[model samples]
Target: MLPRLNLRTSFQLAYRARFGWLATGSLVALLSTALLSAQFSGRQPATVALDTGLSVLRLLLSLVLVLMTQELLSREFDRRYFLNTLSYPHPRHSLLLGRFAAVAILTLGLLLLLAVALALLAWLIGQGYAQATPVALGSQYLVTIAFIGVDLLLLTAVASLLAVVASTPSFVLLGTFGFMLVARSFGAIVELLTRNTAVVTDAENYRSGIGLLGYLLPDLGALDVRMIALYGRMELLPADWPWLLLSCLVYTVGLLAMAVWALQRKHFA
Candidate 1:
C-alpha cells in the first residue's frame, strides 16, 4: 500500500514536472523528421519515414530516459532531497521503486505517442503511391516498436541501478550512456570481427574478447526489428519469441533487484 501510494505520487509529480515540454519537443521532432524524410524519399516515402521516425524515436527516448533518471533519482540524492523522502514512513526500496516506476511509465507513454504518430504519418505518406515493398504498419511495425520499448526499459533499469550505486550524479548519466553505447554496438563489433577476420590481425583474440564481453552485456542491436518493419521481412524475426521475451524479462528483473539492493544500503547524507 505504501509503495503503491509512493508510486502514484511520484508518477504525478514526474508528469507535472517536465513531461509537458518533453512531450511537445519529442512530437515536433518526430513529425518534422518523418515529414522531411517522406518528402525526399521519392518512391519509398513510407519506408523512409518509418526508418527515420524510428531512429528519431530511439534517440529522443534514450535522451529523455537519461535526463529523467538523472533528475528523479541522481539529482534528488545530490541535492539532499532524498533526506526528506527517506523520512517518509516507508522502506528505502519503495522510494527507489516508485521513482523508477514513474520514469518507466513516462518513458513508455512518450514512446507510444511517438510511435502512433509515426505510424499515422507513414500511412499518410504512402497513400499517394505504392512502392514495390510497402512498409508494414500493422503487426510487424507494432512488434518493432514493442521491441524498442523493451530496449528502452532495459536501459531504464540500467539507469536506475546506476542512480543508486554511483557516488556522483553525473556518473548516472555517463554510466547509463556508456552501457547503452556498448550494448548497442556489441553485435556490430562482433560481426565485423567475424566476417573480416582475414582483414585484421589477431581476429581470433578480438572475437574471444568480445564474446566474453557479450556475457556481461545484453545484445541490444538484436532488438532492432526496423528492417522487418520497413521491408515486411518476417524471416528476420527470431525463431522463438517467448525465449527472447524471457531473456529480456530476466535481465530487467536482475537489474531492478540490483538497484533495490543498492538503494537499501545507500547513504543519503
Candidate 2:
C-alpha cells in the first residue's frame, strides 16, 4: 500500500496535453459561431441562433471531454506512460484525482472560452440585427454557462471512471459516449415512460427499470438551464440551482471514488 502520492507529477502529465485539446475546442467554437451567423430563420432568429450555437458548443464540449479522457487516461495507460508515472511514489487514488483535476481544469477552461465566444457572437449579432431581432443576453446566460460547466465536470468524472474499467481507448471512448447519452437522457426517459402510458409497454416494469438506472446514473437533466436562459426565466432558476449543484458534487465524487477503487485493483502486469 503506497502511503504517499505525488499529485504535481500526475497533474504535470495531464496538463502537458492541454494545448492540443484547447486548439481543437477553439476550432469547434469558431465553426459553431460561423454556423450561427449563417443561419436563416423566418421567425425568432435570436432564439434560433442562440439555440443552434449552444447546441453546437454543447456537442463540441462533449467531444472534447470524450477525446480528452481517451488521451489522458486510456492512451497513456495503454502505452504504459501512466504505468511509468505510477512507478513513482504516487498512490493510485492520487494519480486518478490529479489527472481528474487536470482534465476538469482543462474542460472548465474550454467551457469558459466557448462561453465567451458564444456571448461575443450573440452580442455582435444582436448589435448587427438589433432592430430586426429579439436577441437579449443577460447574467442569466452566464448561469446557463455555469451549469454547462458543471455538466462537463460531471462528464469528465464519468469518463475517467469508465476508463479505469475499460480495456482499450476505443472501448473507453465509445462507453463514455454511450454513458453520456444515457445519463443526459435518463430523466426524459423516466418522464416519458411514466407520463405517456399509451406508448409505454409494461409501464410499471419499465418505470422500475428506469428508476433503477436513474439511481445509478447521474441526473444530468437537472443541470439543463439552457431553456431558462433562452427565455430569460430567472425566477425559475433558484429552486433547482442548489439541488443541482449538490447532485453534481455527489455524482462527481461518487464517480471518482469508483475510479480510485478500480485503479487500486488494476494490475499493470
Most lDDT-accurate candidate = 1
Model 1 pairs in collision: none
| lDDT, candidate 1, at 161 | 95
Model 2 vs truth, CA RMSD: 3.4
Query: How many Å off is the CA of 22 in candidate 2?
Result: 5.3
lDDT of 2 by residue, 74-160 (tens): 876889887577777656777677667777777788778777777676666655554343544678788888888888888888889
Model 2 ranges with Cα > 4 A deviation: 1-18, 21-38, 131-136, 193-195, 201-205
lDDT of each: 0.87, 0.74
RMSD of each: 1.6, 3.4
- Candidate 2, run of 10 with poorest lDDT: 1-10
Candidate 1 per-residue C-alpha lDDT over 66-151 given as tens digits, one digit per residue, 9 for 90 to 100: 88888788877888887787888888888888888888889999999999999999998889888999999888988998999999
lDDT of 1: 0.87
Q: What is candidate 1's CA lDDT for residue 93? A: 82
